[model samples]
Target: MTGPSKKTERETFAAYCCDEATIDLLKAAAPSRGWSENMVFSGGIAGAVRALGAMPCPEFLIVDLSDSEDPRADVQALAEVCEEGTVVLTIGALNDVGLYRDLLHAGVHDYLVKPLAVDVIKAAMHSAEEAMNAVEEVEEEGPASEGKTIFFIGVRGGMGTSTLAANTAWLSANGGESTALLDLDFHFSSSAIQFDLEPGRGLLDALDNPNRVDGLFLDRAVVKPSEKLSILCTEAAIGVVPRPAEGALEHLVDTMANTYRNVVVDMPRHMVPEQPEVLNTATDIVLITDLSLSSARDCIRLKAYLKTCAPAASVHVVLNKLGAVPAEVEEKDFANSIETEINARVPFDAKAMLLAVQQGTVIADHTKSGKVTAGMKAVNSLFTSGSENADGQKPSWVNKLLQRKAS
Candidate 1:
């Protein structure tokens, strides 16, 4: 049997069954789920094998094996005629345990023993939809070379979240890994100003139409200040914020996470509620704050939120601009409020930072060796290293956080 070509654009759903009863059931339930019932036909496994040989296989396929003398052999034969990525369901008369296991082993997505109930068919349809969605996620994420998606957010505004995020992305790329800096804020972007590059409309285009977000789409939106680093940032009009496209940020980050070794997101606090899924996908969460009482309280709030949404990712509480604010809350008290020790502390250096801004460059790049850069280097190292405890064992990220608290 000739297999369906991968190059052909496949239809959404189709079914071939031995009896009119099954076809009628699919026709009734299919339209409710936005599937076309016209694709439903009568003929069973032989029909599927015959029709798919000439046409492309659909994303979801169901075939009847009720009339087959040898179901296992027929399924194996059917696999030869379908292309990869086709999710198949089999309906048969027999309910033997061995037969169910054999059909699944032969790559059937699900098996239904007739007569099929309405709810059971609908449930199977939902499961197949989830399966198709999962396949799409994997395809969008690209190769098996998994990349880390790291998010940096401030406990309160003007706490240097973007500064730390941009520098971390730069430092990560300086180490020779492919890195992407994703500024999620459409208005008042800080990364472009820091990197000395103009913002592009590619992010707006991608957010507006997720279907157009691919490597080329990203290439158009991103600007590379260094060979290994790619940055996507924009400054939209102050009062205008467009509605977020469904699954746009998810698809974009998934594509970038697989495409690069690291993705550093400069996430505004508003996005925590707007796109919580972005936080959920992060491999690392960096919470930037100062030593003030407000910072301490919000650090507690943001850390608690991160646990609910991203338990798998490590939560890092960074004390930025240490000693900058007079009458600042004591370090021990701030740590007590959050119930977690500061993972790293970046001391304040106004003159050096202003000098770098004057030169339109990163402080770490301008002043290669300083106490400020030293603290930054420590934070950057932890950002790339992930949730590894000092014991060299990979433990639960929560446990690692608790260990930091206990220590």
Candidate 2:
């Protein structure tokens, strides 16, 4: 099959076809479309891959997937080699609606059934040119806000850490700050389920390949419950949990924080000592606990650990499910033990919480003025607008000062 010659100059349009008819149609349309006739090649997806891999991808590209073994996977491979705004259209032999939708979801500009018509090719190219122009306009606007990371860690299990984290992200996003809820629990995460969404796949790949994670990967991997809120979580099968390689988790968080205005991490407390490196750049670390003697001890242990690993992070305490059961310990006593005051206390509102859980929503949405809802709002306000931690406590500054004096 004929293929593209090694050309040093970048082309505005390029086409790779498997048949003589398709090649002739593209060549005929090239002059009118301001494309070089030599850019049209008689090789299919394979030749497109070889040529594009060597040269910069054209502004508009058409590849014949008529011979592609797995078109969706092939398109994804093309995405890896292509720059951010390279508009791609796939011409295939099959006219299946399922494949069409799958290709769109995989980020192809459009899919065209190949019979080789100039009008059809030109129309698709026009739309693609518009799409590329739109991307350029957006890039001209400015970069997105590089946001802050807020980690919600429960001192012990059954402390509503996930709920608090999800609600905090929801409030932040709904209040017009685009937010990302990153649930680090590989298996048994409820962040997506609680929002009535299926947990997105590919979080494992993202963690393992942080350097490769980008907007395209996030668009496919994260579940967006609303325009502003996105959730990245996974329910991996029961197996040996993959610990993020050294700085992998941190890199992923940094990437996400660069995209959204706030990143609320639903951190499993077990990961505190296990993956402490991920806490490196956290702006705030809110510790959730109950009024129990054991939880109080765990809070102390966690506080000590945070001081070592994330000393720059300002820490806050949250007492949830107050009065759910008899007083194991007084709230004041629990706070005193941890050497911090309770930032937010969400009392046990069984009716409201049950309604929210059953309806797959936050308690604030179900019972707007209920005590529990108010408590959740209070938790959201912790990082609503601040550089320091909640309640005017700026321990991060203290840590910086102490470091300076030590030097």
Candidate 3:
């Protein structure tokens, strides 16, 4: 969000073979999303690509045949010129369903009408990646490869939400899971900071040119924390506001859901409009809190509200800062108060937490089998367990209790 411009690791490039008007729009939109290099060849689609012999075949390609006198021939020739793995996106002048269907049937990844934007491009790349991954998975083993989307939300301020989210991504990535840590807490987001990365350009710039959002933009925006874990964060809190475009939060969650085996969101506490999108889509929503009275109340309110807004998402409440002695409020009482299971009770370790925060490390990484690390392992187990219900709704009593308290 409004962060500094991030460089791409993969040298993601794009080829835009379109007419003058489309070329101009694409040129203006490409750089804001931090597209590494975009080449616009203004000529008939077939001839322009044929000239290259796939010289600069991109991970993704966009072509506009809006003004072509022979639309069918132009499309066929463009398809013929594309390399085997290159994904082609076509922007057509027609709004006819038949035309759209035909293009899709002819091996086009996606078909957009005139006046395309970068978001469309990004969405197409995500789709292509998903399709390719699916094929790869099928080839490697079978069609049963499990995909997971997890959202980690801090029940209150400074409960180590960002750290846990980052570690979860690392765990998944290092364990051969494709993981993404998405930080949407605009002003005070910390995913990049924890990894010691300077705020770089990311989602904010992409929103400026939503139509041009693509895999290249994503590659440019995300910074690799490790070989396995990649982070997308709000750039440093600049003077400009750091808010996602309308429905952008939803789009982001949806895209992450499709691409990675594990999607971890470092969510803001305030349940804004897009909160539902992430919570509703998550395989499990982990609400982290401490064993304080305030935290318990907040957790209760969160569970209740979630029941209303995202009935299908399972809410797993975790009590952080658990010490040797039990919390003043008994665990059973806490669970009864919230009307849900207490997924984890992460122990308190002043030294571990302080060291981890000061050093910007996860508790699991900084310490051995201490109390804190053990609790973290327990939390990890909850994720692996089959008890989680991705589509289960909370009981109505949970909502009624929260409403009464609100009144």
**lDDT values of the candidates?**
0.77, 0.76, 0.62
Q: Tell me how far candidate 2 lies from the true structure as C-alpha RMSD in angstroms.
A: 12.7
Q: CA shift at 243, candidate 2, in angstroms? A: 3.2
Looking at candidate 1, the ten consecutive residues that score lowest on lDDT are 392-401
lDDT ranking of the models: 1, 2, 3
TM-score for candidate 3, residues paired by index: 0.63
Taking all chains together, the TM-score of candidate 2 against the true structure is 0.61
Residue pairs clashing, model 1:
none
Q: Write the per-residue lDDT of candidate 2 for residues 1-407, one digit (tens) a residue.
A: 55555567656788888888888888887777677888888678877888788887777888999988887667666665665556777898997655764554344666778675787677666666765664555456444332468999998889889988988888888776679999998999999987889997768888776534544556678998899899999998888677665456765776565456689999998888889877875979999988889988998988999999999888999888888878798877877888888888888888887898899887766677878888889988877654533322212212332333466
TM-score for each of the candidates: 0.62, 0.61, 0.63
Residue-level lDDT of model 1, residues 98-126, one tens digit each, is 56544543446657788888877887787
| Local error of candidate 2 at residue 257 (angstroms) | 0.5
Off by over 4 Å in 3: 1-134, 141-145, 236-239, 273-275, 324-326, 354-360, 385-407
Question: Which residue runs does candidate 1 get wrong by more than 4 Å?
Answer: 2-146, 386-407
